[model samples]
Target: MEFRVLGPVGVWNRGAEVPLDGAKQRTVLAALLLSGGRALPDSRLCELLWGEHPPATYPAQIYNYVSRLRKYLGPDVDIRRQWSGYMIHPGDGRLDLAEFERLATLGREAQENHRYEEAADAFHAALALWRGPALMNVTEFLARAETHRLAEMRMAVLERRVETDLLLGRYAQLVPELTRLVGEYPLHEKLRCQLMTALFRTERQADALAVYHEGRRVLAEELGVEPGPTLAATFRAILTAEPARTGGPSVVASSWHAVRPAMLPPAIGDFTGRAAELSALAEVLTGDHACAAQVTGMAGIGKTALALFAAHRDRDRFPDGQLYADLGGNRGNAVEPQEVLGWFLRSLGNAEPSIPRGLDERVRLYRSHLAGRRMLVVLDDAADDAQVRPLLPGEAGCRVLVTSRVSLSDLPGAAVVEVGTLGTAEAVDLLAAVVGKRRVANEPAAARRIVRLCGWLSLGIRVAGSRLVARPHWSLAYFAERLADEQYRLDELRLGTLDVRARLDGSYLALASQSQLALRRLALLEVPHFASWATAAVLGVPRRTGDEVTENLVDARMLEVTGTDGGRRQRHRFHDLVRVFAREKADHVDRMAVAASRVLTTAN
Candidate 1:
């Protein structure tokens, strides 16, 4: 028999799992196992199992639990009763916690002996023993009492493993994981220091410095303390471009300190699954060949968030610098390319007086500055290809990641990555992140229905999660029940500035009048998805002109294309949330109302 507490509490006899009944039962077993072969006082077990207030019959309850365990555990595992206290001996059976400790000790000894590879492997093995948070299947009292120590133990092992990987010179491989860790534990100086070193070693001095500055800011805001001496010294090395060989973390090339700008926007902390999209984006952003890719999707589909996430993950890979600009793609007055060029020039250490007045001259000077230097430019919410064109560097070593509602395919040699809504699993994970995991675990079926009602749109899910978070007294079922009403789902999916209606409104208003009419009218058609003929027939226009308007809605991201063959064969539809918004628009607006009524009648 093998007992495990690193994740869910359970016992495996041979290869099959042995049923451990009830949270209280699991708690009793975990409390005893964690006592480390020493007997735990009956009172302590009572407190762990039933909180501070145990009933008068607590001793009897303890006796009943242990007696049940003894019968199930058999003669191989010994449960001893000594002076009104309890202890357990695994005997021939193995306990995962004990094995984890043994492996961690071995890893530490290996590191101390300079066997870094063995150390890394040992630490990896020890960590692999954990499936998730420790004692996760137990009662809240037991989990709360034990999780802190286990979590700290895990973080310590992870830190040591990261150190070993750093010694192995796996800089690129360390970046994505480190970015996530640093985001999670922003207050931890050790993780902050490691991330800085890995970044500088990968030739991202700008990003390394940015990490230090962010840490400094967070420290000041939260605790009113500056960075410690170790972090400060590492910052000095990156800023000075000092080379350290077994001496210091001075890893950047001497010439790189000139103008290392780290201008990536802060990544979404609760950004959930997009494994395939992130992998594809990472390949495009970090690979040898391509330097520019446009991440385009429907409004509020999390295009910007994904772009920033990928950019920050590979920020260290681009050695010279990383630059960012918001071209305000959704705005009526998008930021001009010349204005963005001036900002980039200043970040590159060009004096304001030296910046040329003409757009052509600025582009020349900007490209000239980025000619040989490795850089990552993130142009978020771009208006179009024209707004992004001049901002892009002319060098092969530099990369540009742009996010927009429309496909910026007009940009020469740029790849367009179309982002869709989250899958059911990813959608639930995202909702869980925004709301608490415990709440979702308590009401999983409701959680699934909530994300489904959201049409799996990232913004819709976030907004829905935010609503539940604001109304803490509301149950997941209550929220899911509220969302089931289609007429008010969009309204309920709103909480202080995170309105799905507002997000869709921006994209809707950005469309041409003809496209807007087709969009709102098509919503009146009341179908899940439709082809061009449906739209062409509804709009009372010629097939060719109606097709152009429908395709325009697709290009503008106000509507999603359901088919991919091209020309008249193309099919289009609004996401569930987007359809709701369009229908709401149709009902509210006086001019579109008459046409919408006729379209609805025709469809029926």
Candidate 2:
């Protein structure tokens, strides 16, 4: 028989789990197991089980649970009622808590005698006994003291084991685990110092220093104090690249240099407008606290450009490095998170030979490298939450920026910034910036008209401006007249290599069958915006389903929320360019309106 309190309170007989019944029985067993072979009175057990709310029949209930446990344990375990209370004697049974204590004692002795390898092994064995948080499924009130004591002991043993590992010169191997540990125990100076030492030994001098700065920032922000002397000394040593050696091999260095990857694609030269968004991004990314911002919009709405522009403008702040990966979400067959981590690890100075092989291990190593560094990680064109989730740094010193056409609502704690079409004035400014201010200034009305025709979208405005740049002889009015025809507006909104219709097609093809049908039907309404009821009328579905499909389109950036109407009902509008694209996808407006009127009349 073996008793375990490391996880849920339970007993195992012959390597098979023995059923312990309800919470009361488990509580009784836990009280006796934690007693270390001492007797626990019924009164103490009652208090543990029910606190001050013990019923009049509590003693009977306790006896019933005890009797049941005895029958379950069989003849090997003895549950005897003493003069004071009940005593459980696991004469031939093993107790995991006792084993943990025994191993921890052995580890302590080995460490005192300088048997680092034995000490590390013993401590690791003791720590591994914990299946999860101690007595996790047990009642909080019943397990509070034991839980705290065991958790604190576990942490102490972990620190000692890490110290032993450090003594054994396992710096490179310890980086990933130490990184995770520091995140878990951010306030522990010992762990922080150990991590700094490990980084320094691995020749990541800049990364080691960055860890120190991050620790100082975390301490000051979280606890309103500075790092203790030990951590401070480690930081100082790393700053000078002269780490103190305590009977370990000397650090071999000379060839390795900090990798500062300038991977951001060039920001658009005439990246006009988005002043408010720029300021907001600067404020969020520049803060000492780590954060993530998600930029979402339709295809060709400048989601990638906005992210790149912000990252480039704030490049100097992240002295550690800048990394960019196009997840290829728009192009389809998006890059996997593992692939991105591999590239990021290499960019962070990790050699190919040193990078972990497993996906999870790679993620850990990637985050470890970014632990203390102030870097900007921009994940562009992410497919969805899964692709972006694993790539997030989750470090205070680093800031993550993600761009996707799909809403990353699944990314917890991410500040969502929706990039919409440029305002009319901003759109005109972008045209002027691209086609030369002299031409735009000469025909300001024509420029405004041209932007309106292009639906005030940055890409649309840029494409229109590029076309005029190629034909300097043709005035803005000439292009505006060309785009004036609604039937041919999308076809005309194209310049060498820039095609609005192609971009719209990509977004359209990505939608589900129902949303596609809803969009096609709604596009034929010819209104600036319509309600879910109208969508239901066209799709021949319930209003509720219509609302769901409408929101999906919005999430896919196919529709924009204009505002609520007079009756306080949501009225969704389409981007002018999007309307044209939808019409091109489904061109039966007259028939759609006739069917819509009949559906509306029948519903009324």
Q: What is the C-alpha lDDT of each candidate?
A: 0.78, 0.77
Pick out the ten consecutive residues of candidate 1 with the lowest summed lDDT.
248-257
Over 4 Å off in model 2, which ranges? 1-256, 351-354, 566-568, 587-604
TM-scores, all models, native as reference: 0.56, 0.61
Residue 479 CA error for candidate 1 (Å)? Answer: 1.1
Q: Whole-model lDDT, candidate 1?
A: 0.78
Candidate 1: count the clashes. Answer: 0
Identify the runs in model 1 with alpha carbons over 4 angstroms from their true place. 1-257, 564-568, 587-604
Question: Candidate 2, residues 1-604: lDDT per residue as tens digits?
Answer: 8888888778888889998787778888877877655566665687778887889988789889889988998988899885336888888899898787678768867876889889989988998998888886666557753565466557666776777788789998989999999898786666777888888887788888888899889866764555544566677667776655555543322222446777888988888889888876887688532267888888888888888899999899888788999898876568999988989877776667656667766655565456545788899988886688778773445788999998664443457788878888898899999999999999999999998888888888888988888888998898899999989998888876799988888788888988887777677665667764666678777876676677778768888777666664567878888888887777565356537567434322
Backbone clash pairs in model 2 (N, Cα, C under 3 Å; residues 3+ apart or in different chains), count? 0
RMSD of 2: 18.0
Assess the local accuracy of residue 207 in candidate 1 as a C-alpha lDDT between 0 and 100.
95
Which candidate comes out best when scored by lDDT? 1
